[model samples]
Target: MRDFSCFSENGVQVADAASSSNASITTSSSKIGQNLVTCVYQCRLRNFSSFIITITWTKNLMGQGVSVQIDDSTNQCLCKVEIKPWLFTKRRGVKNVEVGSKLIDIHWDLASAKFGVSPEPLEGFYFAIVVNQDLILMLGDMVKDAKNKIDASGFAPNVVFVSKKEHIFGKKAYSTRGQFCGKGKVHDIMIECDLMGTNDPCLLIRIDGKTLMQVKHLRWKFRGNFTILVDGLPVEVYWDVHNWLFGKLMGEAIFLFQTCLSAEKMWASQSILEPSWSGSLHRDPHTQGLGFSLVLCAWKNE
Candidate 1:
């Protein structure tokens, strides 16, 4: 049984006065009694925008802790406050696991442009999944590089704390996880595409799949620019598609992603395998054109 009374602030957990680094808190869910709380040290990472956090409480507090990693867009401490009472008793020989959400809205800028190649936050780039409230996996840059064959995937501490059921209440551990797109219900499908590659120009088309297409006819219009339409209707698909396409061409990759309001969707993105550089003005010999792509994946309501 982890100790919930040892916390200081409303949700701030304070460890020993001598060890503030390990300070954590506990909060109760309206539906349940109390849930464990985890904190991300935002100040520690100088130029980062988000922090991933995880929590662990007793079975009475939901058995396993409700783990969800949230991005701090405002550059503040984003905490996951679970209001449920579920006791989590660890089985002597069984392994418990849980997969959380994805951080699919990360923006890439100059910091990642050095080699004409950009990289997601080495630590905060991936999604966090928890098991039985003890074991966890922070899959970020490691999985990516591993997938790319540039690095290895075997890393520890990537899997956080682990403990038995009866010993959870008064004990302390660390882990992280988050929710993306779904509000916790469950979404098994997501469009997975990379916005960082140069050789290949990928196209993502957005459409109203729910609606019927007449003759399957589409028009392409270029007014000092490129434009495309669906069912003879003007849309911003061109802009959205190009942004993702050229961003990858320019070497800025979209490691994270989201979608729009309508059901049907399409867009284009590129990627670069080598390091490159970009400048504002054209140089003497290499009249390099400054190319920029502005892709908007998440729907914006005006």
Candidate 2:
């Protein structure tokens, strides 16, 4: 695990993860060009054991694909299933993976999946993870079809949405959808930064078409955070645009929208650092009411 440094600025505590060679937050130009969305969930397996499941959707030159990985509480990868990108074949299949002594069945049907501009499916799909005839985790809109195919009972699986990481690209403005809390309203998030031919650029953030936060002199305050109210809850927005302002041509910026309830207390306590999207699932932020985090790796389209 990497360490994080926290400091106070204008009465708001800023937690920054230390730079590391293997940091997943930094996305290269080649990877930034690919559309990817990774969602993490905390689920209970057999014997009430907790596990973290990561589902990543990808779309590139080849085609669209999805990968599912399950990790135990100790951060050890239990099993992983990758559906490689296919050009013409039906985008669906089933894979049975052996984890320890248990046989985990992974089922996905995207033959009729609907997608917008993102790689993730908007609907008309079903992804299910079954352990011992019990559905551990399920996604997409075709729940009935999934149950019938798996021959499982009709019951909602107990799972907590942990975090989501996505790559967004644009020349000066980037937009995406986000849900801050469980069962909360999904809002449209827009980030605008006009740096072309400007010495001092300003950063603007809007939620649901409403301007919520703005930062001027972005070159000077390239790395900072602010808090805003959404759905009657406080959401802390952290951004690090050092790369966008001074890094290489293809460098990308990072923006994190965190909906932790006790954010201020967590910052004051400094017990646990903000973990990376790929490596933070084991901590189970949902237990502490830390809420969900949406990480956006914003890239400039050249």
Candidate 3:
């Protein structure tokens, strides 16, 4: 195995080192047969304290479901609510949990939620998190219904999407969608690596069907990174495919799409590796001056 401790400066590390430090990544990656999409958002609660809300959507043999977790700036878990797999009576419900002295309410109605190939819902759903009677985070297209049901109205919650982590499986092509910046247009991201019956494998990455980066001599350069432009923003693309090139048959590859305007400055500083799997959600985005990050764990399907 390659020593990844030295690559901390560039925010890239070997899978073993990365997984050992991040419990979430280890947990998600171990579920090789399931599809998971975890989104992290930063928002200030009614008390003016910033908190991180992690929402994870899961799809497996049982069915599809969602889980919500709130953690304070100190990385202390305040509360968590999990909506079990779909069933007749579990389609819609509300859960109230007391965090410290504050009561947090989680409301969701996924009975009519529509899903695509991904576990995340596409429409016909409303997921709202209320704190101190104020709607702090809201998701889905049922905005009017959410507002009516919550019975709290003022201005929209000031939520900043911090990062996203998804687990995708494919034979030779892995694909997903991502929004590089806030309120930016979503684009299709496709990663293709054909290693079957060939002496050499090449890596091709495309955005919106347009090739952005291509690497030859895959065996010699299987683990590296490059800079790309998306929506006029500087994005640092990193990949670690050591497992794919040399590890077990079911080994997965990790790709990170990090958007940070100060990427140049960041590269200059001696910072530890903060790959998407490293759990960037624990850090405050505003204070860190970090942009959105998307981490895709691509598993090769046999």
TM-score of each: 0.18, 0.82, 0.82
Clashing pairs in 2: none
Off by over 4 Å in 1: 1-37, 41-49, 52-58, 73-302
- Compose the digit string of candidate 2's lDDT tens values, residues 85-178: 3665756778888776777888888889898668898899998988766778889899888767885544588788888888888777787776
**Worst lDDT 10-window in candidate 2:** 1-10
What does candidate 2 score in Cα RMSD to the true structure?
A: 8.4
Higher-lDDT candidate of 1 and 2: 2
After superposing candidate 3 on the true structure, give the runs of residues whose Cα lies further than 4 Å from its correct spot: 1-34, 85-88, 264-287
Q: Output the number of the TM-score-best candidate.
A: 3
Q: What lDDT does the true structure give each of the candidates?
A: 0.23, 0.72, 0.73
For model 2, what is the error of residue 2's alpha carbon versus the real structure, in angstroms, after optimal superposition? 26
Candidate 1's residue-wise lDDT over 208-275, tens digit each? 11111110101111101122222222222121223233333322211121222221222222222122
In angstroms, give how far residue 69 of model 1 lies from its true place: 3.9
**Which of the two, 1 or 3, has more TM-score?**
3
